[model samples]
Target: MQDLLDKIVAEANVTPEQAAKTLDVIKEYIVEKFPMLGGAVENLLGGNN
Candidate 1:
């Protein structure tokens, strides 16, 4: 997910830590909104690793 992190850092003009936190928030929101997709989301996003 380094690619995603790089894109977010460049496009959003945010630090790496901020970008990571943003991703975490988004992942949580998606899982919360669609509980059934939690596994899929974790797989896709790599689960904050």
Candidate 2:
């Protein structure tokens, strides 16, 4: 989400590249740990666009 990315950029004071990587890792963890959710996130993220 753009709002989430904005918040992370401001609060974490990180570069765009770093923020993207961080978000990817966070997403990966969620998918890995919450197998039941499966592609729910991908769908949500896709809807965001």
Candidate 3:
């Protein structure tokens, strides 16, 4: 998770908080669109499954 956040921060020129929020939005979108993959995504992305 930290690795991804660091990449996003560096590539997007965004702050840590912004990168985190972007990840949250992406997580929510994925879970909403593909409910069955929610657990997998959470596990991979460091969230409560």
Candidate 4:
């Protein structure tokens, strides 16, 4: 997750905090819409931490 945040910050030129918030929103939506794939999505996002 940290790595992704960092990459977003670097590549997208966004702050780390912004990156985290963005990911959190997307993750929440995905989990809500696809409950069964939540675990898999989390893994792809880095992990279920």
Q: Kindly give the number of clashing pairs for every candidate.
A: 0, 0, 0, 0
lDDT of each: 0.92, 0.73, 0.91, 0.83
lDDT string for model 1 (1-49, tens) is 7899999999999999999999999999999999999999988888864
Give all TM-scores, in the order shown: 0.91, 0.75, 0.92, 0.74
RMSD of 2: 3.0
Off by over 4 Å in 1: none
Q: Give me the overall lDDT of model 4.
A: 0.83
Off by over 4 Å in 2: 46-49
Once fitted onto the true fold, the runs of candidate 4 whose alpha carbons sit more than 4 angstroms away are 44-49
Cα error, residue 8 of model 4, in Å, equals 0.7
Runs in model 3 lying further than 4 Å from the true structure: none
> lDDT per residue, candidate 4, 1-49, as tens digits?
7888899899999988888888888888899998998888778885533
Q: How many angstroms is residue 21 displaced in model 4 relative to the true structure, after the best TM-score fit?
A: 0.1
Q: List the residue pairs that clash in candidate 1.
A: none
Give lDDT tens digits, candidate 3, residues 6-32: 999999999999999999999999999
42 Cα displacement, candidate 1 (Å):
0.8
Q: Which candidate wins on TM-score?
A: 3
Candidate 3 residue pairs in backbone clash: none
